[model samples]
Target: MRTLRRSTRGRIGRIDSRDAKTGIGAAELPALAGGRIERVSVAREQDSVASRFAERIREEEELRLSPLAARSYPAVRVRPEEDCALRTPFQRDRDRIVHCKAFRRLTHKTQVFVAPRGDHYRTRLTHTLEVTTISRTVARALALNEDLVEAIGLGHDLGHPPFGHIGEEVLDSCLKERFGEDFRHYEQSLRIVDELERDGMGLNLTEPVRDGIVRHSSRAPLPETLEGRIVRVIDRVAYINHDIDDAVRAGLLREEELPREPIEVLGSSGSARIDSLVHDMVEHSATAGDIVQGPRAGPAMAALRDFMFEHVYLGPAVRAEHAKISSVIRRLFEHYVEHPEQLPRDLAGGDGTAAEDVASRVTDYLAGMTDRYCIRRYTELQVPQAFAR
Candidate 1:
């Protein structure tokens, strides 16, 4: 087949069939010399097919989706670029979040258990996938943007520190003590996408995706879009249910010990509870024109969340490791703060930058570690040379 003279993106300039056979390599030819070339066209047939798929998605979204749903096309980004021939903007954002380094690090990060003996215990990555899946289900049912919801869900927890919430607490404490600034994982998540990932170039994610990620935590403000709101609520849904399963598996809690009222209202099993919550969300959100839970499921899920906090999250079994985890985090924080040079060059602010900036960078460095990596770093710092190696 003949090749057309085109740019890197496969956009061909005006050229004739005879010129197409020449296969312009490094050789520079006359620019449509004397207008011998005809009008421009696609060099590859697949490009047109891929563009049609993207266009079709936009058209379907417009026709089928609810008016409240966030549209995938015409997505807003901090840096504008050409749309993908094969993907909607939200789909591209999802792919970017899925493929980034922060996403990969989540696999080794903690969800609930610091280091469980059982392999089936959920890691941060698993928790993220669960949240994304559940959010997508809710989005689809409500005629909200599934791709947008999915992007938000997948990227929401990308900034969680090692060792789960405990890591977050310790980091927060460290920051408040030294810099008088709070360290919330949700904010850090925004920071990750806005300034940390891509070596400070950021993910360049859409505004909706970024907004959803930073607001997924209940402590933060609600997200702007209904799709973002779905992820925010479903984040709790995913964690509260899955964490219970993990707690039971770890022998930290028993099935019978669960609060009887909430258990009966939601369900006996994890799957049942999730199903109930998803249904409630879809039903209420469809009517409310916003993501919300039904009266029974909302209070019931809240009750279960409260129960987990009291019995499992802040309970003795999990708290037993708090001291050790705190020590590791504090020592690491101190080490990095004292030796800001140890942080990545980008994080380690240049000379004349405020001391608080250095401390903040140290927090970023520590917050990005995995459980085993954090422990290893602590051991390497504290242990004797003969024993450390």
Candidate 2:
């Protein structure tokens, strides 16, 4: 018979070796031994800590949240199976958005500039972070649900196609021409979380988070929750200021060239502008009991947005690049529609649906691609490369 021995590793009751001839089961050895076996309660301790922290957070929300703030205790969409012991619904939503493949793709997607030569230019992911920062600042000031606001901000642009709005426009045009369907990024964002993510399993996000994501664009209706509303406002605030900074960096616009009235009212620089806008938003929204900008600051920000559209967004240099990007997107879209089999297996439509369904799937797959990925795919399909010997 082999002598039984215990190893003094981090875990307790770990059998060091098996005695095959002894006919003793490893698990039964502890019970069989006259000696007492001690079990480490690590999992129990961790669960206790997590449960206590979660309870404390709930208590904090009940005590500290404003009357207008969204509460996490009773989420609108309850998925008992998906509920977390450690995180609130909104917190879970934020984590899901952060960990998602779409969010990861944002790192290489266009924000304002498409594949800018300089590394300092912001990508879609950086822009999302900035928006979340600005939204949380406002939400915290209002004593609102910062978690909900953050989730919305982080996910607002998840469906934006490569090459920024230009790519969106090209895809929309192709879809319209082929299937008479429109491709709106905000709508696509909702689709991403609801259906396209996690191998078609979706994120199972909360109602408020989904509402905020779909309505983050100014063109959409206002969100029901004040937390969502905060993100809706801050999304514009982040992009306008950051786009200005990028435009300046790209030598597309100078500080002096920016519209004087809006600059004077908002601020002279990007950081100053964001600070001013955030302060104005907090002050006005607090007073009105709704998320809004001050009388003066609102118009100034609008003017700034208009200025960007005319200069940085639709300017000659950007328009030139937009033409090239539009061509790539349009060609790829058309090629895929013509040869549906070329699409990845998932997008090739095994559902026995109409051609329109295949077209929609193609649009979803293409829209999710990053800027560099789209360019590379286009080059691979369209450009003739020499075959290696």
Candidate 3:
């Protein structure tokens, strides 16, 4: 008979791991990455696909503590090889993203405020941090991959043009009509890494992180993992409440303007609204098995999201600004696609290929424009800035 050590991690439930280096109790499970769920069904109870999914989830969590092969792959990363490097491949990607110039520039970009003329409002940098904050918390709590989640959160905004979505819409409409709907931020993000970053380092992020970021968009998306789902929700959570705050600051929205029902459901203060949202999302994803509207606070949160879109996102003043910026971007696209030489060097010339290929190269050049650059280009082309003689 084998002598079994007493179970320190009571939650394993005869799962048997006296050899298990990391004893995982229920408390440990909740707190693993930052309060993520990490339980799998007992090995003998594999009766259905749903159970298998849960088991697979549990296995992933277990992988974090497990030691890799006897040797390390140094070319694969910048960090040194260690027995249990807390920083995984995905984590390296996160650090690289943080160090990148584009990530740092987010501080000057807008979240809601146009000029952001103040320091306190949510800039793109603050928004990214907020998303990271919520994404890590949810990923840790669900026992999903925190490194991948954080990476997704970090990479999610990499493709954002200057002045927030206003810049994107501007570029999209401008480039799309003539370029045949070829410009979108997600694909551009993929481009930044493939062709743009540091003469093409592209960050070389892992597959899961790429998938999460590609599908994070709301419209016409692709399949993704649990980490991606968390990112999708985090994007919404960061924008919805923050937009309301910005609108209020810009005097477009008033505390009194909130519809009574949404106000009750979302709470008054931004922090309270965020708390309600995060708690609701965690509860829903745990119980309903997805973040879609369902029992356990899902419906209320959905209502609040919708109320935000109606009262805040689509409000008239913002739409007018979106239109104005969109026009500027479109004009630039028309001008550049015709005079491709005027574009930046890397963007102007590509291997001979499809006409849209040329347009794509042009779009690549144009999309990278800073808000100031785009405005300057508009001035050069329209105003004849070549010195009045």
Candidate 4:
């Protein structure tokens, strides 16, 4: 009987030198001298649908997607992982963002209006969906990677705090005054995905998705990928038009009050304006080989944006609530600052950690709250139990 020997790797060694020369492993050797074959398999794994699915998507993307479009095959995650059987990297990223707890909290967070009584008003979650829809439409027209665009669009505003921009503004001010640091929703969004989510392990999202989320704002640096660029531009397009609809519905602005010249150049209604803008963007970006808007529609959109800021965004209607929102945020900030033990254990470092670190944790906790939750917590802290009930 042939004796079996173990290799240095703890695997079965070749039965003889002849098997090594032939490149055959011990598994294939026939039994001899009345010994049964062990049949230790040594062949490479066979190709199948599960193994080839992602590669097929990459090949299809190479054929149909724009030359400048980002590819998902070579996904760059902060931590490496195995490829999914069915979803491309960006598709997987979209799934992760959708499933995460932060994304769910968006439903109760403010968009333009803070806690509107009417159900039709857009919340942060709806805004995200709108941006993703518009971005996908533009991406499809441009032959860009729609999956990447969708992922970026969905994640771009995940960092926005409750009470809309008012909450963000107060939080920023509180941080600067108390800790000599500043806060921005975009930066916080990056931190959430990189360090805060999943009880501090983050989402482990791909590099492109993370980049698109943090750079979707015009105030931030431009994104590296064309898909991210699409989201950056479309976010404004989605918000400006939707905010107008919401404003009119809230009786804060009349459709006729819109700037005449810009209205004529773009369109009278929100849908018409979006259509004109999308068409202009498609034509201009195709020619420029980058996401851009034509002169007329570009200036028209900008004019509309300016008009919104003056009348709807920063105007009397919304500003009236500013003081109330500010008080809620500042009071909460001070309360947490004086009592770091109230922070979640994951965010709160050890007792020996720096005060600045604790302040940062407070910021994260507050920023993650929904609009109603923020107000509820504020009431619970400030109001007498009899009055609160």
Q: Which ranges in model 2 have alpha carbons more than 4 Å from their true place?
A: 1-42, 50-54, 78-82, 348-353, 387-389
Model 1, span 203-317: residue lDDT tens: 8999999999999989999899999999989889999999999999999889999999999989999999999999888888778877888889999999999999998888887
Q: Candidate 1 clash total? A: 0
Off by over 4 Å in 1: 1-44, 50-54, 348-353
Q: Could you give candidate 3's per-residue lDDT for residues 1-389 as a string of tens digits?
A: 11232232223334334224445543233324456656543432423433344344445556642221111122233223331233456776778678775677666666654655566788777888888889888776665667778877887777777667767766776655665574567777666654566654566766667777777877637435677878887788778878778878878778887766766876887788888878777776665555543353455556766876676566676676776677677777777667666665654345434677667776776666666666677777777655622
Clashing pairs in 2: none
lDDT of each: 0.86, 0.84, 0.65, 0.86
Give the alpha carbon lDDT tens digit for every residue of 1-389 in model 4.
34465443334545643343445544354523345545433332223445667766877899999898898878899999987876888999999889888899999999989778798999999999999999999999999999999999988888898988888988999999999998899998888888887877888999999999999889899999999999999889989999999999999999999999989998899999999999999999997989999989999899999999999889998999999999999999999888887767777354324777877788888999998899899999989989999
Candidate 2 per-residue lDDT, tens place, 192-221, comes to 998888887788899999999999888899
Better of 1 and 4 by lDDT: 4
- TM-score result, candidate 3: 0.72
Model 2 C-alpha RMSD to native: 7.5
Assess the local accuracy of residue 335 in candidate 4 as a C-alpha lDDT between 0 and 100.
Answer: 92
TM-score of each candidate structure, all chains considered together: 0.88, 0.87, 0.72, 0.87
